[model samples]
Target: MGIKVVKRHGSSFKDKLYLPAIAGGMKTTLKHFIKNLKDVDNLKTMQYPEVQPDDLNERYRGVHRLTKWEDESEKCVACYMCATACPAECIFIEAEERFDEKAEKRPKEFKIDLLECVFCGYCVEACPCDAIRMDTGIFSFTGDKREDFVLDKKALMKNERSKDLDND
Candidate 1:
C-alpha cells in the first residue's frame, strides 16, 4: 500500500473562527460553576486534615502488614514466597527453626523497605499462608532518614496492633 495525500476543503466558517471553540469551552465551565454554586453543600471536595475521609474502597491497596493468628502468633511459615515475588526486592526474611507444632520454620528477621516498595501487592498474592496483607489503609507515611522506612517484623505487626481489621 502507498501513502496518499488527498486534497480536501481547508476550513468551514465554524472551524475557522475561534469564538465557537472558546464559547464551547466556556459553556462547560459555566455549567459546572452554576451547578457548584447551587449545590455548594454537596460538593465532593473534602476539607482534609481536619475531616478525615472514609471513602477508601474495599480493594484499595494501602500499606503492608503481617497478619497474626487468634493467639497473637505470626501466621507466616517463612516460606520466602513474599520475598521471591517482590518486584522491588524490598522484602527480606531470615528463617529460623520453630519448636512449635503449628509450623516447622518461622521468620527470625522479616524486613520490608517501604521506600523501595512499588505497592504492587505481589508479595501478598504470592504467599501460600494468608500471612501478609496490604489492608492497613495507611497510604500516608513519612520518614526523616533512609533507615526509618525499613520496617522489621515488629513494625509490620504493629500496623495491625491498635487498628481493628475489617473482617470482610
Candidate 2:
C-alpha cells in the first residue's frame, strides 16, 4: 500500500509578519541582559586559569596515561588490545620480547596521537592488564609543534595518575 502524507495549511497573520517571534527573542535577550547587569556576580562564568571549577566529576575521562607496577616498571604487556579498540586509531604500540623471563612482552614504542584521539575511553576498557587509564584530569593540552601532541612511552609513564590506580 502507498503511504498518504497530510500537509499543514499556511502560517497565521502573526507568523507571516514574524514580529511576534522577533519581539519574543528581544524580550528574552533584554531580560537576561538586565538580570546579568544587575547582579554580575550571579553569572556562572569563571575567570579561568585563576579560578577553575571545583566540581569536576569523579568519572571525568581526561587524558590517557600508562600505569606502572610497584617496582616502577611499565605494566603494559603490549597485547595491542588498546590499539585495537581505539576507534580513532590514535593508539600506536610496538611490542618486543622482554629480556626478563617473567614478562613475555613489553612495549618497545608506545605512542598516542592526542590530536586524533576522540577520548572515548575504549582503550582504557580494552586493556586486560589494567595497564592503560584516562584519569590524568588533564583535558586541556597545548603545544607549538605537531610532534608535541604525540605522547610517547616516557610521556605516558610520566603523566600517570597514581591516585587513580589506588582508587581502582
Candidate 3:
C-alpha cells in the first residue's frame, strides 16, 4: 500500500468562532417558535396523558396483540415461526394439542417480554395465520416491574379490539 500525505487546512476566523452555525440554529429555532406562537396546531408539543395523539400514520406499528377467531378461540396455532423469526428473541410460546379437530395446536403458554421486544413486526409477518398484529395503537405501555411488562397469552388476547371480542 502507498502512503499519501493529505495537507491540513487551517481554520478561518469565522470557522474558529462557529458563529454562523450557531446563528443558523438560533434563527431556525426562532422561526419555529414564532410560527408555533401564532399557530398552536403547528407546534410539535402535545398534552400527553390528557390528550392522546389521534394522528398516527396508517402503517404505524405499536404494541403486539394476539388475535382470536370469531368463536373467541385463539387464532395462533402455537407455530414457532414467530419466535424463530424475531430478531429480539422476545416471543416465547409453548404449544399444546387443541381439543378441536380443525385446529391441531394451540398456545398453552405464550409470553412476550415487552422489555426485549423491538416492535419490528417480524412476528406478525412470520405467522402463517394472521393471529398476531401490532395494531393496538398503544405505544405508551408502562410497568412497575419486569414481570408486569411481560404479557402472557390471556393478557395478549385481552388487547384485542372490542369489536372482535363482541359476539353480537
Ranking by TM-score: 2, 3, 1
Candidate 2 positional error at 64, Å:
1.2
RMSD of each: 3.9, 3.1, 3.9
Per-residue lDDT tens digits for candidate 1, residues 1-168, read 799988665378777787888999999999999999999999988887788767676566778889988888899999999999999999999999988787999999999999999999999999999899998888778889999999999989888622434654
* lDDT: worst 10-residue window of model 1: 159-168
- Candidate 2 ranges beyond 4 A from true positions: 1-20, 162-168
Task: Please provide TM-scores, in order, for all candidate models, with all chains considered together.
Answer: 0.71, 0.82, 0.77
The candidate maximizing TM-score is 2
Which residue runs of candidate 3 sit more than 4 Å off their true CA positions?
1-6, 9-24, 38-41, 162-168
TM-score of 2: 0.82
TM-score between model 1 and native: 0.71
> Across residues 1-168, which tens digit of lDDT does each residue of candidate 2 receive?
899988664467767888988999999999999999999988988898888556666678887889998788899999999999999999999999988655899999999999999999999999999999888888678999999999999999999563533455
Task: Give the whole-model CA lDDT for all candidates, comma-separated.
Answer: 0.88, 0.88, 0.86
For model 1, which pairs clash?
none
